[model samples]
Target: MSKTQKPVDELSAEEAADELAALAAEIARHDRLYHGDDAPEISDADYDALRLRNAAIEVKFPELVREDSPSRVVGAAPSGTFGQVVHAKPMLSLDNVFSDEDVTDFVASVRRFLAFPADRELAFTAEPKIDGLSMSLRYEGGRLVTAATRGDGTTGENVTANIRTIDEIPQTLPADAPDIVEVRGEVYMRRDDFIALNERMAETGRTFANPRNFAAGSLRQKDPEMTRSRPLKFFAYAWGETSAPLAETQFEAVRRLGSWGFRVNDHMAICRSVEEMLARYRAIEAERASLPYDIDGVVYKVDRLDLQERLGFRSRSPRWATAHKFPAEKATTVLNAIEIQVGRTGALTPVARLEPVTVGGVVVTNATLHNEDYIKGIGQNGQPIREGRDIRVGDTVLVQRAGDVIPQILDIVPEKRPADAEPYVFPDKCPACGSHAVREEGEAVRRCTGGLICPAQAVERLRHFVSRNAFDIEGLGEKQIEFFFNNEDPSLRIRSPAEIFTLKARQADSLTKLENIDGFGATSVKKLFAAIDGRREVPVSRFLFALGIRHIGETNAKRIARHYLSFEALRRGASEAEIPQGKGDPGNSAWQELVGINGIGAIVAEAAVEFFAEAHNREALDALLKEVTPVDEEPVGDVSSPVAGKTVVFTGALERMSRDEAKAMAERLGAKVAGSVSKKTDLVVAGPGAGSKLKQATDLGIEVIDEDQWFERVSG
Candidate 1:
């Protein structure tokens, strides 16, 4: 490890292979801790040093590139809780370069790929690489239908409901576009908001390790409102599956995306050459400290769309793009104070509000203090003080913020600590709820035991229930929900999920008071009522899931709805045997078992059982039912058409029904409509946007039906 070796005469083949293997394993372990657990054991400086060393090794010995090498990966595997979603196109990692020679080599490679002259000018787009999850937002006929997390390049979890809660994300794009398009972006927490959020989380006695972890956890939450309240921002960087052409160059594409209502990263450049690109990268690195949020690096893309297409992709990354990361940001500040904050869902977090100091050109006043174990350097052991320990008041702290975004304390200088300073202790009671906060067995988090009765818990829970991803009652958006609850008389507090139903009848004399609520307005109030009215009938799946039962999720709700078509049927059919039991109280095991059916796991079953068994929950359910009817699932044979229960596909120039119309028809007839063909695809619908799916269906010898054939089959 002490030997200094050059690229060409570095080491023997065996030595290189051994070192490469060692580096890959080390990086993967750190990646898991950082990305997966939010408990990184290394500083950004140290992590980059490791990454840079590994990349250099790979550059020297390309043969050492294993399939699982971190050098070739963009992100780690998706966290366990969220459902999986696949990308239409793989989300690939970008190549990296730190020096002028590397930039020149990249240009040379691009020129070779495009058969262009060295002197010929080429366009390029450069933007900050925000530190957050990569996601895809898909629109059908200009309306956002789904948003998905970029899971393993091939598949990802669907987060349509949570994405809808992001006010920055457009619900509808302009009508001039294609029938379908996928917009790609990063979801991040604003530095200021991240501080506020952690403060709230701490008060609730649930400590989040960092903003990125909190952001990811919030976005992947089964409940959409949980994501909504977290102040997440999105920056569009790429596009996928456009019906029409986007732009001539990558720069234009970003511009067009911004024009179409997507928030593009404000810091970007259109470089004409490698020199200009390098200069742009340097400029960004210099100002990184001034940015409001965290960015890991700067990204550079080959400008022309045609050139990009020609460069295509190599295994996991595109040859047309590379990330030019700055030599990470580091700073020092005095730890002013550590405080706890509660979240809308009652998660408590620890916040470190530091004495204002400039870091990487940005003013740094706050950093994440993490949890009690984290503060004590117990969670990650003796890893760097930056990745562990909670810096306390009067301690001299080293802070690091990459790209001026995510500010974190690197270490504590013991010499600066007051002699009387002691290890901080987390409170046993929720500051907001005054409830005994308990850290359940096997869980690191300490949550308020007040449940929904606690003031903070009550407000947060109600907010969660009315969120866009849950009941999605139109008039009851986040602002309205806040307005309705916050303005309620203290004596007549909106204490339960059932209480939301009584809002219309409650006394509110003026719109002024209502409008004065944190996020409400006149038109918004009207929209809220209309949305609430529109939700008089909701799908049984959504209705049940909206109850915010601890473990039951969207998928579980669907299974429960399919198993029992009506509320009465579910209530009567669920038995003790169906409940999934584990250690602890096991809640309502019998009721859990009844809804627990095949797909419902032990966790979900227990939550369902517990919810149904609770008398208060049952009364809330009754109240909800009075206002909204839950639609029963369509019976197996309800579609009386000839094509009923038959899988159908439409393909090649539709003469009759629009593809969406055709799919809807097939669904109505109880047939599953598929996007692509496999051994399982029954009928292939391939009218335009019909790319590889049509060919696959034909190759598989599956029935290939044109638009007319699709209409004829559905009509039959």
Candidate 2:
């Protein structure tokens, strides 16, 4: 564990919940950039770390899991540039393991779940985990019908025309193949091809970042002829939505795919034991660089189809398969300077500028410093890092791409440090707005207090409001947000969310028209207006999240929206809720009610109350609400469910399912899952060791039932 992160065992439930919310939002944003846009901001290692942290927290506090948790979501939603194709079978992602011990545990978990004796041999197929775009080719009656890119697991972009251009993907399957089969494979560009392509495009000044990105860009091209011009290959490894059984085992199925005119990796092998699995992984790693395409790691899957069926899957990944990722690559570089970048949340993040160096085939010029403490060789728990040797300008620092993607400084070479190098000083004020930057207790990051006044923060917040996960206005993105924020004409400028909805009206009244702008043409300006008008009514959850309240992300926003059912109700609740006076203060009824919702805590309640209480925030919110209507979220699952819209609580041990699972089930039945029993609780599900909550429920005259009875009532 990094010193900056608190141990999972040590984190309080409230802290865990807050961190989970933040991680979900951060990961979602990265998913949009990486999966939807094919432009990643962080390296693979950094992304994995965030996910691993989330998993650890979820393991320690399972009941705190939110509906929008990263563990439950796959790739981002389709970008809407192509026709949408809903997968017949969901295209789930694989859970990742970074260490040998984790791999061993994974196998042990499979045996434990299957109740298999230790002496019995279990076979698994180990293959190279490709680093490329996942494409699903659907065949019907031995003819190719559609090819789609995995988009959020359930839906994908229809790239059938583009896919047909690749010779490696067969236009028709062999007669022996299933009548309907979705052959899942990876579309990749060979390293040499990628290099040549870059060289060819150098004259145009538009080169790709990596082979994986190049393959994705080529496959997503709107014109099929353009895709045909690119050098792309496919390797089939799995199947989805098969009309008939293809084979009895994993290896056999892959062989059948190869016989049916799909490229199957020759390096794939069957491993019957843990030792064999590890040996195969090592062998694959040794030959990874020599391969024509990139392989990030080795994927191991249960070979037997029966065993795979029994193991089934988790919410987002297979229970019988996992990806064992390769270790990060490191290099040494000179640190020239440290720069501060302010985020929409006012976080003052430090970035280290380094002399250009190559690590893992990618050019490295910058790395994340994390925070002031990290730069000063101080850990979050006040421990020493790198023997308490602080980093300085001109120091030769060891850097690595975390997950072969994100560049990060590991430590400095003391002998290479310049004699005149001085201890770096962290700024106490915002670099953009000159406002005080203060670090709060128990927090590692220092934040700017400038709020909306800071240009960087304002622009970032505006961008986030129009982000894919929020309001998601089609014509409004980061570049457009920045352009409008700094526009010279007052009528054309958009510094706040309210101004966006009023852009057309403002432009109509002004002497200058948007069409006359440098980048905006008549057709583009009309489309922008239509896009803005399309978002006049948004879901209450998205509306709440767009406000960007501290400690409130998409999951927490949804929780609040579900609890209150409307923006007006949530605002009223926040206004009536009183902040606790001290450590032991119980606070007012409204506060108690807000905190009573499962996955919600005092931290979130306080933040929501604080945001609503601020005079400027209220003024801006009132203005924005005038232009947009926030609609209540439709009830999930069966609207006629007996527990629909009812507040339900669970007490004691649940034998049939885990606490988190029970909560999820109840939620699916359109019931509100509460952490504590109160007058507002409509039902209570009690089990073995039922205690205080059950008594409280009885005293409140709420309906109480045993776990089995509760399940019986909700079962469809």
Candidate 3:
């Protein structure tokens, strides 16, 4: 169950910390799938909701903000397929505003930050927020030197060759342009072009999910010829790393880029007041469909360059600008049926099979039902949703493509429901393995108890083991894993992660060689073996995550791995740890140590202990361990630092930096920052309005210091 169901203010410090850690890991995974892989699982609305919730929690419990918070991250780390380019100026993202009130609050905050009088008119430049790949073109001495994609803000993938193929991008700027200017904009495909490209690719049994995906895929092509064939265009809206200022205002700067032969949006306007900005937003949103290319929203930026500089930036986005996203497009569709899909963790999720409908220009056939309660018209708080109208199989439902991505059922039309339609009876047994599917108290979904015996769970676990953040074996993709898992040949089939290591050996003794297979050539088989061999030695954190343990995501896995340092140590600790029966009950020394490791909560600790306690799990783990050696994490920061390996807690409002920033700084200085003060705490950083944590530190006789003193000691 998600911790976000409860109000942020109502959450305890421990609950807030756990939610923050989960959000960080979840957001990071989505970012990687969207930016790095060009495949996004959730809608932009869903993604935004997660970020908004994280922000809300952080606001309520400032000291509980984690080092890996989503606010501190921008885009995904660059895939190593292309040469990396570190930007001269970081390519930051823009914060989002969903409603008129949010926009008003943003403007009010900006005015407050600048100490500007309410009487004076503030100007903002509003433009269509194009949905495409962000690209940076660097020019030197009137010639385009390089082009790069926005890869994690700090560093980007060098796509100069593919970028040169786009006709809209200027090969050379005028002599009046700066000696070194990095023009930044979106590389997009027109709706007509996207449709035509899809039609062409359809004949070859391959098509892109959307125009944005097509544009991204086209731009990242290793072959320039392949990219040249695609109908891609560019629009200059911003600049990065300018040797000299382009203009005094944001609108003029974009206009200046247009003068240098770059295409600029014709709908760009300057709004003098909040009302005018809202009007502009409505006008743009109304004509969004008629636009040649796709745009998800309208971006509003501070008109004056001086004010923008004064406003500065947040951790990942600029403070002077925000994107007011368009509402989710809605459509009516027939609910054909509901199917249960068992995930890696064995949670049986109900998916709504809808009659095909178009929403936000994308074909929608499936929507998430969330769980049994959602279908039964129950909200997270046990309140009625859609006026307590439950959904039925033959009902006419209103479907919405939230944030122009994943479609979800909003409500059902009671009048249109078929007379024969019956209430969905959520299964009590696992559909795959016939094991009792149990819905534990406080959890929203029913989970299969079949565990390793369930084929669905086993396959999903195998997929997770070889996922990008896990072992990441090069030739072992999802399709290949599925193929090998169900292969008819005994020697070729791989039911577990340990079996993957035995494939080459098994194939060597088999009568039918792997190379003789339809899709496999001798060269391909050799490369696959080499790729599989490459992953024999993986980082311990990734190895633990690959195990697909509940509550143990990438962040928690790293925390556990770093604490244990080795797989044997972790296994021993988890095996010896005792699970507590109630709140505030310390189980054992191992359990206490696990729970006391800063961000590692009791839930995660219990999950680890439970997994280790299972004999089947331990046996499978031992078998896999024989085939792979998990490497320990190298020590980070200076080992000689005074706070190295010491647990420190911060209380109240920090003066110099945010709680996240402070925690990151402490980690860099080799200190482990804990959320609460305890006997294990080595030091405490106390700010104004210091609460129970401060008193606890004093009671424990732990050293306490102010923000300035912290800087002083860390600086040395």
Clash number for each model: 42, 4, 0
**Top candidate (TM-score):** 2
Query: Compared with the true structure, what per-residue lDDT tens digits does model 1 show for residues 377-400?
Result: 655343444445455678888887
lDDT by residue (tens digit), candidate 3, 651-689: 888977656457667777777766666667889999999
TM-score of 1: 0.58
lDDT value for model 3: 0.85
How would you encode candidate 2's per-residue C-alpha lDDT over 1-716 as one tens digit per residue? 67888889999999999999999999999999889878676568779999999999999999999999999999999987877899999999999999889999999999999999889989999999999999999999999988899999999998887788798888987778889999998999888888766533422224466788888998887545457768899999999999899899999999999998889999999999999999999999888666878789999999999999999999999999999998767889999999988887788877899999998767899887777888999854687877888988899999976434446787899999898999998999999999999888777878889997999889888987997668999988777898899987888899999999999999999999889889889999999999999999999999998987877766678788888988888899899999989988878878878988888888889899999999999999999989999998776556689899898898998887656557767877889888877678899999999998988888878899998898789874
Sort all candidates by lDDT, best to worst: 2, 3, 1
lDDT of each: 0.69, 0.87, 0.85
TM-score (C-alpha) between model 3 and the true structure: 0.61
| Residue pairs that clash (backbone atoms under 3 angstroms), model 3 | none
lDDT of 2 at 404: 43
TM-score for each prediction?
Answer: 0.58, 0.62, 0.61
